[model samples]
Target: MEKDFKEYITPPVMLVVLLLAISLIFVFPVLNMIILGAILAYGIRPIARIIQSKLKFESISIILAMIAVLVPLILLIAYIVSVVSGVLTDFLASNPNFDINAVLTQASVYVPQLSPDNISTTIGDIAKYVANYLVGKIGSIANISLDLFILICSVFYFVKDGDKCYNFIKSFVPDDHIEFFDKTVESVENVLKSIFYGHFLTSVIIGIFGAIGYTLLGYPYGIFLGVITGILQLIPIFGPWPIYWALAINDAFNGNYPRVAVVLLFGFFLSWVDMYIRPAISSHHADIHPLILLVGFLAGPLVYGIVGFIVGPLILGITYVVLDSFRKELTESK
Candidate 1:
């Protein structure tokens, strides 16, 4: 009885406890940054290897690869920020009084609850609340900056020493479970590559087309709206419908019926493209189910925040693959 207790209960319990403690100590604090880094690392590793082969310096290749990934992202963010700022400034400058009363009066026709008498007080209170909330979020900027720094460092390390890191992780697994680990790793890489490349390329294509459509329709801030539409495309099911529909309503409100029709038709076309193109790209590469991708896309942002968009689907795919592998192994054994 003592020997059996030592062999089964004690060792397993101790291992579980140790793992829990270690994870709590190391993972909880930087989990988001780690996930972001891992995703970027996996995506950029091949490019880094290609550069390294030519340059003969691993560190230089990794840095160049990081730059290749980050430069366009930085430029896009800057452009979006400038567009938003200009739009806001123009609105405020044009409407010196910024008539909340007129807006509320118009809104009350639809909402039926917004009284013009209370509009001033209600808008004031809401504005104050928003300002306060934004101010509070400002405090987190430092933490976000720190996380970004950590992400860059982690990505560099991952690209530079990915093999060493893999081997180190592999050492922790039991010999009997090594094959499981290897299979999981392969499946994860395939899923991530499919998701990152396939989905991103599709979004970019839709965004460019949406931008062209909006521009042709003489929409204000068309580029900004197009970029937003592209970003929204990352969210499965939701896609760019919300933005396009809102634009259509705006056009209808302004008595631009023809433009509204164009917007609606263009939006529907984009939706169709998404439904068809996304699956073809993802399936051609990873062969993952559309439902799995959808769940991951929706749940990732909800659970993990913005970065969760990528990591969420990835975790789901990995889990599915790992479970499928286990099922096959068990069946073979039986």
Candidate 2:
């Protein structure tokens, strides 16, 4: 043990370790995006391979796959954020024609504990905070642009050469531990599939269904509400409750009793659809517990911000399976 420690602590090895630490420190700020890019590459790599099989040019295939898959994904996220923020900002901005006082008065009738004046003041404070935050973020446009470029490049290269990276990492694993490494890799893949299909794919399906149902129900901002529902579906605990509940309550306040029952029924249906879709998609994969995902989704944003939504679940799932693999290995070795 002494001999091995001395060998590992040689001058050359010490230099390498020092440089590696510095490199990590340098990239610490945007490490979240870099890690997220690597996770996303797992999904994009398969598509790139399929296209390369037909195109015969690796680089072009990756670019095409990114355009097909990643671009739409980025656009979808941007659209949701921009549209929601814009709509809220516009609605909150004082306009002589719009009377928020009347709406709050009606709301107070149902929830007497909530005074109309207090609600109005709270909402005014929130609107001011959101407006100020948006204005402040505007100054960081360059940083956003830089992160976008890094994410794209990271995905592209990771897709094109992920095998090389995998092999490079595997080379460092001792022969006796190769089995453990392989099991961990398999676990990682399963986690990715579980998240991509169970969370994201299901979100898309629910969102589309919501848009259609709300439009049919004749809500004013039906499509917007549907998009919000779909986004809500990504959070395991939230599901579609907020959107449908708000609609139902609004209908009730307006004395539309029949429509209230109809919307509530539709909301329950959406919730039921989620129960079916998540298990059906996730079962064949890692079959991670809902509680694990719930914790990940809730805690991830606090740590990693927006990208945490994707990174949090994947990281937790991967970590869970990796530890499980290690436990099995330890038992078998005994």
Candidate 3:
């Protein structure tokens, strides 16, 4: 009985327990940042490797890759923020009084139960709620910064030592199970890459076209609305329709019937781009069901906030692969 109990506390078992504990500790606090870093590392690893091969230095390669990736992302974010700020400033300037009642009255035409008389109090309540929310978030700024720093450092290390990390993980699995594990990892990687490439590329294409269309039509904040439309493309089944339709409604209200028609036509075209582009890019790599991706995007943010968008789909994909693998194993056993 004593010998059996000692054997039960084997090295593998102990290591697994330690790993589980470490993962549990990180999951709630910094798992999202770590995951994001891992994803970035995976995406940029090829570039990093190529640079490493030429430069003969892993650190130099990682630094270059980080610069190459981060600089554009930073610029894009800055541009979007500036554009959005400009649009808000213009809106406030144009509507100097910024009457909540007038906006409510317009909306009440569609939502018949909306009382224009109560709009002022409703607006005040909403403003107070938003202010309180912002105040609450202010307390988390330091934590957010720390997470961001961790994320950056993790990405660098992951990119530099990803293969070693992968090997270390592989060491834990039995030799017989290693092949299956590798397949699962490969499948997950393909799914993630496909999702990133297909969705991002499609969004960019639609946004650029929408921006050009809006500019030609002399719409205010053409670039800003276009950028928003691009982000909205992340949501399945309702990509950019709300924004375009709202613009169309505004045009209709202004009696610009021709511009409304043009907006509708362009909007329809932009929406169709997803149907063509997403399948072409994503389906080639992984046969992920559209429904799975939809659920991941919709439920992910709900559960994990912003990080859920990526994490949600990933979890679902991994779950799918695991189930499928087990099914295969069962089938083979029979």
Tell me each candidate's RMSD, in Å, in order: 3.4, 3.5, 3.3
- Per-residue CA lDDT of model 1 for 1-334, tens digit only, reads 9998678677778999999999889877778788789889988999998998999998999999999988999999999999989988999999899987788899889886786867767789999999998898797898778888999998999878889999998999999988878877887777887887689989998898888888888988788888999988977777899989999999898999998998899999999998788878877667787788779888888877888888888888878877887897788889
Q: Which residue pairs in candidate 3 collide?
A: none
List runs of model 3 lying over 4 Å from the truth: 1-19, 53-55, 91-117
Q: Give, for candidate 2, the lowest lDDT window spanning 10 residues.
A: 92-101
Runs of candidate 1 exceeding 4 Å displacement: 1-20, 92-98, 116-145, 171-179
The positional error of residue 284 in candidate 3, measured at the CA in angstroms, is 0.7
Instruction: For each candidate in the order shown, give its overall lDDT on alpha carbons.
Output: 0.86, 0.88, 0.85
Tens digits of per-residue lDDT for model 3, 230-284? 8788777779899889999999999999999999998898878878888999887
- Between prediction 2 and prediction 3, the one with superior lDDT is 2
Clashing pairs in 1: none
Best by lDDT: 2
Query: In model 3, how large is the Cα lDDT of residue 202?
Result: 81
Better of 1 and 3 by TM-score: 3
Residue 282 of model 2, lDDT score:
93
Which pairs clash in the backbone of model 2?
none
